[model samples]
Target: MIKLMKSTFYKEEETKKALANFILEAEMLSMGEECKKFEYGFAQKQGRAHALYVSSGSMANLVLIQALLNLGRLHRGDRVAVSSLTWATNIMPLIQLGLVPVVLDCEKETLNISSQTLQSVKATDIQALFITNALGFSGDMEQIRKWCSENEIIMLEDNCESLGSQVSGIKLGNFGLASTFSTFVGHHFSTVEGGMICTDDEELYDMLLMVRAHGWDRNLSAEKQRVIRDKNGIGDFFSRYTFYDLAFNARPTEIGGFLGNRQLQYWDEIVSTRENNFKRFQNCIESNDDFLSLDVRHMDVVSNFAMPAVCRTHESFEKYRKRFENAQVEIRPIIAGDMTKQPFYKKYVTNESLCENADFIHKNGFYFPNNPELTEEEIALLCDLLHK
Candidate 1:
């Protein structure tokens, strides 16, 4: 049976062996040098100034929102536009943190929010945009960036699904003021269950470190720690025990750091394999009349864990879903479809807007596996299934 993912890391057996030895020899298992090293490597590779390691992708979003609030970058009841096609956690932080969320619809072709989508918004109060680069595909991000800049909207990327994807020569995570990533088992990089928040803004970066673990400066650089401590008059007695701002316990274990380090070595190989699989999947789906053609010409790479098949109708969606299931191929509905329709969103948010495209995708979209480990035979089978 074809599964979403066959292993935890790119080289699972080897990674487990290494992890076993590391655990046996390590004097400490808490956040340490290993975590710092992973952060540095991730920041360098993603072309960002800072990358803060977190416990999970969901926590990454929470920490970012809390940091913004603590720094006075955002305030209670401030409107933040969220992509309607995103995962629940992407928009939950807004509702959870007392910020208003305005649902932004995505384009049908790109499976992402375009500048045109922003233009269609009648709401003039949006302070920020929490945009999700869905399924390793992005809209015309350059135009989106320009639009956001002109509108003075602070754009943040929920780039958890599009880690290695590049558009117009810039990585997906670099297109916004800051971005979040997942290093879950099946994501582009795996550290079992981990996340990262990347940004170039030093103020935001400093806030993120403090916010990750009970709002303490323990994780901050000496200079940042010194500055915060000095400002708060936190002397040697209370410095370590001081809790500065609103935050969470989103700290990653040293094990996550070690696994991240091990997985970082195979970033290129993993990304290349997934990109190639995406191309093959694209070719097959584009030729099928029942499935919607995905527009990805703007992307230099697509490093996704799964390939979506947006069928022409709900009946078609069921037919294809059944085909894959019968073939023992695992599949799931596209990223918590039409987030506005979610029960949690409806319960919390009052202002409603039509997201026709996102609603349509909810009824028609289902994604199949496109992991790096797909064998040539598995590819042929998946491709054959994509056909009529």
Candidate 2:
């Protein structure tokens, strides 16, 4: 049976071997040396100075935002702008921290946040801008980066969907002051359940490291420990139960880090296969434009082709979904559509403006399966069924 989504867990034998080795060395899992190695390797691949492993993508967001707040870059009750169409985790940290979430409408073509609307918003005491690379499409990063820099807003990207995506050769997660990634089962990579925060800012990196582990001073280096001791007095250090900053337990298991490291070894091949599948899907869908128009415009706009197509309307979408299902093809909606419609938002968020493009896509858009295990003939058959 066709599934709506499938995990990209290739190299099972290699993964098992890695896990076995890790277990043999250390049975009890906690953020340790292996986690540090994985963090360093991940940061290097993304061209960032530091990457911190966390429990999940949701925790990654929380830790990053809370770190920014602790550093005085962000404050409670300040307005933070985000795309209306995004995963709930993308905006929850803002609400959880008492930051006001200003939802921006999305562009119909790319299904990403509208830079036009984002620019038009009256710049109050806006603390940060959270942008998601919708599905796998790297939104207009150049423009958004320029806007955020000029406005002095903290730029944070939710890159959970677009792990390997780049814009003009610059990686998506690198564009933000800090970015979050998920290595959940079905994403570009798998760690059984893990997430990471990538950034070049030293202070932000240090803050995340501290907050991710119960706000303890233990995470700090000897130099930082000395400074803290000097500032707060050595007696403060003895007060082990004392909390230095508002933080949480967002630590990932050593096993998750081990799995992530193994997965990173095959990232290039995995991304390439996904890209080929994307091209095939694009060609198939474009060939049938007489009846349907795909929302994806170009290859660079998307990173690894996470979600392939965007249909024109809800009626056509329903028809196509039904047709594909009957033919043993699987499809799923794009990122829960417009997130403002979420019931939780009704109580926590205020702006009632219906993002027409986001709403349209929410009702009309669906994604095709992108598993690497599928053979060429299977893809061809799926394409034929989609076209038919």
Candidate 3:
């Protein structure tokens, strides 16, 4: 049967062998030189000045939020606008850290919050826009970026789903001040389970380093570490045990780091395969009037997380769902559905604005597996399932 994740790693057998030898011969296995190497490599590759590796994508979100708070960029009661069509962790950190969330509805075509959505939203006083690049698709991000700059909004991207995606010659994650990524098994890049936060801002990057560890200056450069110690009057001996700010132990191990290094080699191959498959799937959808054709023409590349089919009606959704089920192809709801409909969100956040488009997509949408590992035969079967 076809599955959401076909394999654990891109070059599965080779990575496993290398990891076994590294573990057996290496003296240390905790977050060490390998993790640092991966961070440097990933930052350079992703076109960012700094990249902070974390334990999970969820931790990446939490750490970023904490770092923003520690730097006084975001406050306890400030309102942050987020796309209604996003994963739970994308919004959880906002609520968990005492920031009020204003859910912004997405466009039906792009499945992401467009600049038009920003103009239409009732919440005009939002301090930040925590936008999600949903299903490897983004809105008119260039115009959105200009609007954010003009309005003085702190924009951050939850780019977990769109690792290799690009728009207007710039990567999706680089559009915002800082962006977060997931390297879980099913994502575009896999490190078993890991995450990354990329930013060009050095001060925020340093704060993120402290937040990833125990709020210490251990991960910083020698000069920066000395500055923090001298400013806090923390001597060399006492600094080792000192906790300077509120933080969590979200550091990744060498295993994840090693796996990331191995996976980074095939970013181009993985992305191209997924983008080609997505185009084929899009062609099938265009011919089938039962499903809605997604708008991704503005995007230069789509490292699609999964091939989403949003039917025009619930009956149509059931029909397509049955076809995929009959073909042994797995499918699931689109990224945890609407954020406001989640139980955790409902329990914590009340008086939220209605997200009609997101709610509609939640009921009508299901995503087919579009991983880079899909064979030509599997692609044909998926395409057939998507048609009629």
Residue pair clashes in candidate 2: none
Candidates 2 and 3 compared by TM-score, better number: 3
lDDT of 1 by residue, 174-266 (tens): 989999999998898899999999999999998998899898888777888888889988897889789999889999999999999988888
> Per-prediction TM-score, please?
0.98, 0.94, 0.98
lDDT of each: 0.91, 0.79, 0.91
TM-score of model 1 relative to the true fold? 0.98
Clashes of 1: 0
Clash pairs of candidate 1? none
Candidate 2 lDDT (Cα, whole model)? 0.79
- Residue 2's lDDT within candidate 2 is 51
Tens-place lDDT digits, model 2, residues 115-162:
566865776557789988876775578888888888888889999988
Candidates 1 and 2 compared by lDDT, better number: 1
Q: Where does the lowest 10-residue lDDT sum fall in candidate 3?
A: 119-128
Q: Candidate 2 vs candidate 3: which has greater lDDT?
A: 3
Q: Global CA lDDT of candidate 1, please?
A: 0.91
